[model samples]
Target: MTVDCAVIQRETPAPERPHRRTEGPVRTCVGCRKRELAVDLLRVVAVSNGNGHCALTVDQAGNLPGRGAWLHPDDRCLQAAFRRRAFGRALRITGSPDTSAVVEYVRAQTGAD
Candidate 1:
């Protein structure tokens, strides 16, 4: 007489776990074209000058009512943006945006902090 033994294998279900949030909101820098957290970048909005021309102004508080563009607040990025004419395309403006105010704001903020 002969005897045989058999073994069975089965997989147990994984325990249910709560989903964890990984990343926060991210935005691309129009100047450097780098992806970064929205909080880390400065937001700019397009404003009309009442003369059929549009300009960009920095929204330090991140609460403006128009289309917003993101920047790094760095001199190199600012210069690259201007050189590439990214503001007009980003804001969909037909005229050159007055970036003096934005530049001054960034300079002051960077200097202070």
Candidate 2:
């Protein structure tokens, strides 16, 4: 008499494991267009500079109201974003918003002039 092992295995249930949370929120860099952890990228937002003009500001703490864009803290990424105008589009602003603040922040962070 031969017992069917396949039948016995099919009747057994597999153990379930709990889902594990390992990483924080992931964001895409508007400059390099690469996915990265939110903690690794700088958050940027557009705000009025009191002259009815919108300007880009770096959210160092990553907690600011309004649409936010992510970017790598590198000079290459900064230049790429400027060349492609990714900042204005990502922040949903009309015309070229002032980027002096953002540029300075990146320079300071990267130690670049």
Candidate 3:
């Protein structure tokens, strides 16, 4: 289920254009391969401490500070992300948003389950 960060990174905005919005800031789902806007996607980031590491966390607030990746906010989008490993590939890490935790987060964030 692992996608490649290189691919997602290719589509992400260039460093100088962080705030600029392109007509097609679309990203693909590592799971279903759907093309969608990056913002429509939920941001996922990993949390780590001196303790070594923690589960992947879903950033519903879209404000988490580490290297982040995204997925469209939907059950299908979520399934795709997990099944395809978009987060792992996008963030270039082996771990990311905890599944059940992310589902719950998404439920609360979007008000659905």
Give the best candidate by TM-score: 2
Q: What's the lDDT for residue 94 in model 3?
A: 62
Deviation from native of the Cα of residue 56 in model 1, angstroms: 1.4
Clashes of each: 0, 0, 9
Model 2 worst lDDT run, 10 consecutive residues: 4-13
Ranking by TM-score: 2, 1, 3
lDDT of 1: 0.84
Q: Which digits, one per residue and each the tens of the lDDT, describe model 1 over residues 1-113? A: 88767676799999999964447788889889998888888898988888887767888787788788899988778888899998888888876878888889778877887
| Model 1, backbone clash pairs (residues 3+ apart or across chains), number | 0
- TM-score of each candidate? 0.75, 0.77, 0.58
Model 3 spans with C-alpha error above 4 angstroms: 1-24, 95-97, 109-113
TM-score of 3: 0.58
Residue 68 error, candidate 3, Å = 1.7
The local lDDT score (0 to 100) that residue 89 gets in candidate 1 is 88
Candidate closer to the true structure by TM-score (higher is better), 1 or 2: 2
Q: Write the per-residue lDDT of candidate 3 for residues 1-113, one digit (tens) a residue.
A: 99767743356666774564566577665556766788667677777644654567777786888887666667777777777777677777664544676777766766743
Candidate 2 wrongly placed segments (more than 4 Å): 1-22
